[model samples]
Target: MIKTPSLREHIPKTFADIPETTAYEAGYLVTKNAGWRNVRPVIDKDKCIGCLQCYLYCPEGVIAKDGGKVKIDYDFCKGCGICKKMCKPDAIRMEAEKH
Candidate 1:
């Protein structure tokens, strides 16, 4: 799991609220740039064919197999769109991040 700032300290109002980052948060390329992302990936389970393309292409280690389905960990996903582009079945799509 992504080790984000403790919510018990003071809840982050948005992704931009949390600043400190470790490589464990996202990937090296995106760990400190989470707020810079304008979009986020969301997967359509029915459209997914269990190809694992998203899981393999995801750089943030946020994609995983859960009950034979691809689960996306938004806590660490940097919205880089690698998974969306790698999805042959068009299962994943990037949506505008709502602040």
Candidate 2:
């Protein structure tokens, strides 16, 4: 049996305060808002070694291999900071998006 982490394990308890109905209705709203204001991963091309480590480690599938560099999809990036943490060459850095 493959084990998958629970949503509650990843989402903070504060999110539970949202009523189920509102939560359902606001899911897209939340995602849209996150895209507008959440921190985004910026790749320093010169620092990247073309190792593809960030592409393999992003949980949100935000990182994409672009030729010899990596690109981040801000629309889907949740700012989890995992890519920054996993980059072997320390090429990825998190920067807050201007709201």
Model 2, runs deviating above 4 Å: 1-33
Question: Residue 74: error of model 2 in Å?
Answer: 0.8
- The TM-score of candidate 2 is 0.61
Q: What lDDT does each candidate get?
A: 0.73, 0.66
- Tens digits of per-residue lDDT for model 2 on 4-52? 9988786535423322221122235444534444687788999988666
Q: Candidate 1 lDDT, tens digit per residue, 1-99? A: 988887676965653443333124344444444676789998888998876767766787777665566787676678899998999989888999999
Best by TM-score: 1
Clashes of each: 0, 0
List runs of model 1 lying over 4 Å from the truth: 1-33
* Residue pairs in clash, model 1: none
Per-prediction CA RMSD (Å): 13.3, 12.1
